[model samples]
Target: MCVCTNRFLRLLIEKLCLPTYCLVDCDPYGFDILTTYRFGSMQMAYDAKQLRCPEVCWLGVFPSDSEKYCLPQQCFLPLTAEDKKKAEAMLNRCYLQREVPRWRLELELMLQRGVKFEIEALSVHSLSFLSKEYITSKIQGGVRI
Candidate 1:
C-alpha cells in the first residue's frame, strides 16, 4: 500500500488539490480509517492536514449487503466499544446503511469466485471513459465527483 503520513496527506491534499477521498474498505477497518482521517492521527496519511475537518461521508454498509457479501468464516476483528456503539447509532439513523455496501457486495462476489480486483484493475481506456462519465454525471447532479 502506498500509505502516507497524515501530515503528508494534508500537504498533498493542499498542494495537489486531491479529492477528500473516503475509502470503503471492509467495514470494521473502514470505520477505523475514517476515524483516523478525521482525527488526523493515522500513521499513514501522517501528513494529512487538519486545516479543517474534511466532510466524513459514510458509504453504504448495510446489514443486507453484509448478509449477501460477507464471508461468515472470514476472520474479522471485533469492533471496539466505540465502533459498536457508533454502528448501532448508525443503524438508528435514517437511511441506515449507505455505497460501501454495494462495493463490498461486488468485492464479495469477486472473492467468492476467487477473483481479485484492485483499483488498477481498470483498463486505461475503461478508466478514462468511466472517469469522464463519472465527472459528467456528477456535474449534472450538482455533486462533487
Candidate 2:
C-alpha cells in the first residue's frame, strides 16, 4: 500500500467518519487492492485493526459492466495465467469468506468470465462517462454488492 493511500484511508475512516468506496479495475490485482483497503495487508497485520476500513464498499468496473453499459469489446482484456493464480489465492483468504462473501462472489465471477477491464474503459463512450454516467447510474440503482 502507498503511504498516501494509508494516510487518506486513516483520515477518511477516523476523522471524517465516512464510508469509503473503491472503484478499481475488474481484475485480480484490483481485487487484491480492494482487499488490502478493507482488511489491511498481512505485512502490517499487527496494526490491521486500526488500518483496515471495515466500512469500505466496492463500487464498480465489475465484470458484468462490460455488457451492462455496452462498453466496446476491445476494451476488455483476457486474464493471464498469473492473474488466475493470484485470483485463486485471493479466493481462499479466510477474511473474504468470513467478512464479505458477496465480494468473493464477484471475484469468482471475474474468474468465470476470464476477462478484465480498467475503469478508464468506460471512457469509450465519452470522457465523463465514468463520473457523470456509469458511477451515477450504479449508485442510483443500488448496484453495489
Please write out the lDDT profile of model 2 over residues 1-145, one tens digit for every residue.
Answer: 8746776887878888986778999999888888898889878998887777777788877887788889788998999999999999999999899988888888899999888999999899999988998888877887775
- The per-model lDDT (C-alpha) reads 0.42, 0.86
Instruction: Summing lDDT over every window of 10 consecutive residues in candidate 2, give the lowest-scoring window.
Output: 2-11
Candidate 1 CA-lDDT value: 0.42
TM-score of 2: 0.91
Best model number under lDDT: 2
All candidates: CA RMSD (Å): 9.7, 1.5
Q: Cα miss at 52, model 1 (Å)? A: 7.5
Q: Give all TM-scores, in the order shown.
A: 0.36, 0.91
Residue 51 accuracy (lDDT) in model 1: 31
TM-score of candidate 1 against the unseen true structure? 0.36
Candidate 1: lDDT of 90?
A: 38
